[model samples]
Target: MLKRVEKAQQKWGGSHTVIDNWLNERQELIVLYCKIAGFSPYEKKDQSLPEPSQIQAFCQILMDYLSAGHFEVYDDIAKACEKKGLESQQLANTIYPRISDTTDIALDFNDKYAEVDAEDLLVGFDNDLSVMGEALEARFALEDELIDNLYSNHAD
Candidate 1:
């Protein structure tokens, strides 16, 4: 996704403020997820960091990453549509913004960890996996619809 954003910037040749904004939105959600999952020093790194080998850290990262990707991509498209005066831009509002998604992630973390002591954060990792899996399902469905629309009126 970062590559795609960079490529878009290179192709367009201007300030990629929209891409930067989108990426920043995702970064915040990831930091929030790290906080809820008991990962320390949840700072966004300048360089790509090594993946945590721990289960809970891995799950939290995966979920937040997926959620962030969703937000950033849709936000970019939304901005594009808005620029073009297209009604489809309004669809972006149908889904929760990045902050809302962050809150949902924190709530999910708290709920799953409520009964368990802080020592067993891994117990809730499966829940995050399930949530992310469902999100992927929904994303694929939307992509399918988008593909259908794109091909539906093609020249014969």
Candidate 2:
């Protein structure tokens, strides 16, 4: 997951400020996720389920990333597509609904963990995080395709 995000950042990093910011937020989210999951290079000092604060922080970044994509990055893509012609617009149309499905998954994750007390967090956290990770991975791929196809024409 981290490798994929890094690849995306390398591929599209400096194309636009909005994209740069969005991708950076993605990196942050993934790092926190890795830490929480006790993944390689981020093994926790204590093996307990992640602290509520960590979940809250992750959710905050998650919401920010989602908002920036919808309100800023995708808005720019839509505007660019208008100028890029019908094909670009059609590509955006085809991709947008799929991305929204991933968004729904991420939102469900946020609702599940954003404010749960410590005891409540343990019930299905591993499964929930695993699901969230998959949704995030799918979303990143959709986002990369959105940029590669739509923004390629918009490049100056």
Candidate 3:
């Protein structure tokens, strides 16, 4: 995820302020995700689920990131495509429903685990996390493609 975000930044950073800020948010979100998932190298090798408070905090950041992508980033891209009369609209129309489905899964994951204590989460938590992680990976790939299209068509 970090690698994909870095590639996106390298390709599209500085082309527009919105894209730069969105990429920065993506970096922050990934860091939070890594920390929660115990994927941070700086953290210990304990692959246990984080505490309830940590999960709740992560959920907050996740919601914010999701909201920004839907409300600000996607809206801006659609407006830009409309302004430029680009066929990106068709791409967006194809991708948006799938992205929304992924968003639903993410939000469901957040709601399910946000308030779960570490002890309770130990039961079947790994499977839930695995599903959420896969959904997120797919979501990120779709989002990156959307960003690439937006940048290629509209960035100056």
Candidate 4:
């Protein structure tokens, strides 16, 4: 029993670290988003749409975040659940489709606007940004649910 608990800790400890890093990345993304969207310190009066390069940078980060979740984090959670002999299929079924839907929206947003020059962004870009923001907000909530349902249970 001690060995089993130690192994579970070993498995979950690494995932907990990864989840912490991912959460930090999410915070950074949120700040960058607010900067580009002209909230708080980047007030509307002094704000302009971020440069094309900036958007590209954010898109790269966004892609990294998404990739890490799918390729690393989710796999780790599934493995941990399997190790514990817990049934996570229902959780996966509920969350995976929502996450996939969000991924499609994010990719579409990145493709459409990541390359647009600052000048082009001045014309009707707000609408697209608004949609992206909403999608991201929903996505983040869904992701938090996943963590709570899956990772929190395994936390040492």
Best by lDDT: 2
Taking all chains together, the TM-score of candidate 3 against the true structure is 0.87
Q: Per-model C-alpha lDDT, please?
A: 0.44, 0.86, 0.80, 0.70
Highest TM-score scorer: 2
Comparing 3 and 4 on TM-score, the stronger one: 3
How do the residues 26-55 of candidate 1 rate in per-residue lDDT, one tens digit apiece? 444345445443445654444222233433
lDDT minimum window of 10 residues, candidate 3: 40-49
lDDT string for model 4 (16-93, tens) is: 788767766666677777767777776677456677876777787878888888898788766765665445556766
**Comparison by lDDT, 1 against 3, better one:** 3
Q: Rank the candidates by lDDT, best first.
A: 2, 3, 4, 1
lDDT of 2 by residue, 71-131 (tens): 9999999899888889888989988999999899889999888887767736888898998
Tell me the spans in candidate 2 whose CA falls farther than 4 Å from its real position. 45-47, 153-156
- Between the candidate structures 2 and 4, which one is better when assessed by lDDT? 2
TM-score of 2: 0.91
Error of 2 at 72 (Å): 0.6
- Say which prediction, candidate 1 or candidate 4, comes out ahead on lDDT: 4
Candidate 3 Cα misplacement greater than 4 A, ranges = 40-47, 154-156
Which regions of candidate 1 are displaced past 4 Å?
1-52, 63-72, 96-107, 110-128, 139-156
For model 4, the stretches where C-alpha displacement exceeds 4 angstroms are 1-15, 84-87, 119-122, 154-156
